[model samples]
Target chain A: MSDTSFDSQTREASFGDYFALLKPRVMSLVVFTALVGLLVAPGSVHPVEGFAAILFIALGGGASGALNMWWDADIDRIMKRTQSRPIPSGKVGAEEALALGLALSGISVIMLALASNIVAGALLAFTIFFYVVIYSMWLKRSTPQNIVIGGAAGAFPPMIGWAVATGGVSIESIMMFALVFFWTPPHFWALALFMKSDYSEAKVPMLTVTHGRKVTRQQIFGYTLLLAGLAIGTGFTSLGGPVYWAAAVVLNLLFIKGAWTILRRDEEVAEADNYAAEKSFFKLSLLYLFLHFGAILADAVLMRMGVTFGGLL
Target chain B: MTFRPDHELHKRRKGRNIGVGLVLVGFVALVFLLTVVKVERGGSLQGFDHTQRIDMVPQGSNK
Candidate 1:
């Protein structure tokens, strides 16, 4: 009849706690882009293979998330944004996270190879390693260019999906990679502009914290312009069609406008308005990537139905 | 008594245990389905899991 003992038990690791270590939100993005990449590729995939490819790709992403939590536990304790993560909140042990991440990494790689081509499996393995080792361990706390480099880790899933179907890399896969890569800096810099305190407190040298907000805003604008050009240009490739072209034109115009608005504001105006422009830019970025991939998927479907979309070319 | 009372640790970790069980089951099923699909598509027995299964290969196989 001791409440103290039960109080301790209340904080013990549960299934949900372990799941939280996987960073399900980030895994969802990996799944979405990878699924789009698979569906939009030139060759056809067996449905089961496609399902297994996405599943293991997601597992690989989740494994990296767990390993990232394991590595960043110290800073997660300090950052308000990451304070409630499993390790920081004491629901999961760092060692358990390391174990789960490693185990899942091996299983996912092997299973993906068995279920699909070795190309996809190898890319998934490399993605996990790049995210956990290169980005999380090496670059994260060391440089202002961390997000720029780490974004490559997030951008690999779609490429891996493309590999699953075609069994090799291609121009379209590289384009998808470039799309996510260029989009990452602006998207993260916007969050950094508003959540400035988190990076400073954690001593993570984010672009905003190191280069100052004015420069960060400029970089966001610069990257957004590049992203707009790349996104609009992707529509003219074999990946693009009338459907994709329309989506790209509208999305990029809105995106460039958002980035321009962010670039125009100083911290004075941004803080006065509670970072409304920066926050909206962050929200739009989520849609920007999703709709770009969605448009590509729609184009692929139309092509499958024997409809020529070169009229708007 | 064949059915004894549950241990306190077991009672506390029921959800975790069940979740792990389900995951294990799902993994087995996925592997099974993958094997079936690979076989149905006329894939060789040697490279099923990306492993070189020499024993499964014929004796005179110059692969």
Candidate 2:
């Protein structure tokens, strides 16, 4: 085993390590939501341009993830969950990650401009900047609200997808953005509840670390309620459909149940087998967002078939 | 340093793994290169213009 000490010259990077830095999982989520946004919007986009937009958005997301990995290498090294990450494991050098991130940032933004309009390109660029600069550099170390604000960066993909379709932002796109924005706090807080030691060890000011566990639980429930409201309400917008509405209702109920159960558990009960309640909620949160977007895609398909739902039905 | 019984065998297998990995990487690169060429020669994004307007509704109906 390599020495645990942080050193500049100890570990050489492999291709897999570099790939891991891109956070391919997160990038996939960005690509899917952005694709849904583009497909469901009212306006038309050229097929080539739409493909390019999604490609660029995915690359931009990857770039942000790379930069985040670069910046958080220190804290990542200390945290068990992140210790195997490229930078922390010394498989990829920080400078290389930074360079890869910067290069991809420029390429993705430029390609987006060529493929689509300037608006989509600009949004893509800003999303990268927000994740790398605002979220990683500024908020992450300074406050527990890091993920809350950084969540906006993740939220931009849908809006960019909308811009690719319409060449402008719409209320519908913003609603999708808001859905993600509100959902982020509770999702991440649940994660923090389970991974409290990870943050505490890294000296990161997660909500659970800065505040007491009870406060974090209450906040999680509060955000869950807000997320449920926004999610259902968002389905009433231009993008909403019977499929989306049904999905939202089911997902939100599950999400609320998860949050409520987490709230009711004391630390003793939660930590009985290593924060089982909190961990389960965190895992479910990932599925919740994905199912919601999947429902949106389904709704779009159903709407295309000329199916509408009436109150009685 | 402590050595497991299979350490030498594992070390020997590393070369084969590296070779296979490189070949896979090369294949993927070649595919990407062909795609870029095709994209450049052919039109954009596989020419998927689903955005073409189909006008069933009267243009000035809203007006």
Candidate whose lDDT is highest: 1
- Write the residue-wise lDDT of candidate 2 on A1-313 in tens digits: 3334323333555456666888999999899989989998886765656776787799899999999998998998998989988887767789999998998899889877767779999999999999989999999888988888989999999999989888889888998888888888988888777764677777788888888889899999998999999898888887788778888988899889989998898899887879887888888888888888888878877777777676327
Local distance difference test values of all predictions, in order: 0.89, 0.82
**lDDT over C-alpha atoms for residue A45 of model 2:** 66
lDDT for A33 in candidate 2 is 88
Q: Among these predicted structures, which one has the highest DockQ?
A: 1
- Binned by DockQ into CAPRI classes (incorrect, acceptable, medium, high), candidate 1 is acceptable
Q: Model 1: per-residue lDDT, tens digit, B1-63? A: 498576554565998999999999998898888878877776345544665567766689796
TM-score of chain A of each: 0.95, 0.91
Candidate 2, residue B58: CA error in Å? 20
Among all windows of ten consecutive residues in candidate 1 chain A, which has the lowest summed lDDT?
A1-10
TM-score of each: 0.90, 0.79
Task: Give the per-residue lDDT digits (tens) of candidate 1, residues A62-160.
Answer: 999999999999999998888999999988999999999999999899988888889999999999999999999999999999999899999999999
